[model samples]
Target: MSYAPSTAAGKQTAQQLADISRTLYERGWMPGTSGNISLRLPDDPGRALITASGRDKGELTAGDVVEVDALTGLASPPGQDRPSAETAIHAAVYRVTGARAVIHVHSPYATVVAHRATATDAVTSVRVERFELLKGLGLNDPTSTDLPVFPNWPEVDRIADDVAGHLAACREGPPGLLLGDHGITTWGDSLGQAKNRLECLEALCRLLVLSQSELHVSRA
Candidate 1:
């Protein structure tokens, strides 16, 4: 895929992505080099600016940005470096949902939720309920929303397939999903909106873990 050059704006998008990476890292949602971010070029549907692999997301810079073909998930501009190994997952979400940005992070809350949900056989059945935070999720109404959790696979394409299937079946609201023992992936119509949703999801997951811990303490 190719997009008309928006050279000036592309630089700004790179900076924005770098800023988000550092923010997520500081919050412990993306410790080490465990997350990636990508933003769609405002003027081009076929190209995206994504974080290059192996950089410390906490210290990302504009130089760490790489352009990619949004459709084929390939690096653009020929000799530019490859994107994060998870780039395919980002591309899949964009292809499936028409979203303009995506955030993936190995957050503690998200990782804990994934493990807890898997152990209890609730990976597919667990529902986030009766929380005001649900509103932030952009569901049509403030009601219980079931967030699907898929088994983790090393191959990004397999995980992407499972995510695509879940979204197809759910068929409502903003795009977000959890990979069991991995992390969360969320997207939105714009970069800011996507970042908001990612933060909200992380917060909600943390709250759930805290509440459960308190309940266990009380029971004991």
Candidate 2:
């Protein structure tokens, strides 16, 4: 839960997160300070650097990150800036998947699909099959897979609990999960790989939305 005072704040890793944050913000996926990103320390996977809460993603600097204990999601070596409220979700992903980086964003299409697919108290899922972008998700069977969508609970730690349970049960799951009425969270071996997976999943969601629109028009 807590770590000893770390002398270094992982400035290099924070800078990398800041760079990715700016890029995602420019793409309109991380508008305002609506999303968070985290990267595990290369030498110490138990601890990670997450973007500081309430900071504009577009304007983040290397100092804009808080190092946290991955297992407990607490700011270790506590700093003035707090970690994002959704740090629990990132921690769950790392704990369950052994991913080195995690990215959460409010990209519109993914958000739309998540809302559309969510119709029950229990978590719902949308499946994409035979899409070329499926390769980007690193699934063993690229032709088909289901993306789980969880309700946007007011308490974020509850959502993280669901994520950890789902991922642990489905070892070969897709690279990402969607939070209904919220956004998408993705993870991978590296930040760049995670970013690429986000792009691929967002595009797939866009295509799914467009196809549904076409179906409605045809029925009309």
TM-score per prediction, in order, is 0.88, 0.92
For model 1, what is the error of residue 139's alpha carbon versus the real structure, in angstroms, after optimal superposition? 0.6
Q: How would you encode candidate 1's per-residue C-alpha lDDT over 155-210 as one tens digit per residue?
A: 77887776666666667734577777888889998878988888777777888888
TM-score of 2: 0.92
Model 2 clashing-pair count: 0
Q: Where in model 2 is the C-alpha error above 4 Å?
A: 1-9, 213-220
> Per-residue lDDT tens digits of candidate 2, residues 34-53?
99999998778898989888
Q: Candidates' lDDT values, in order?
A: 0.77, 0.86
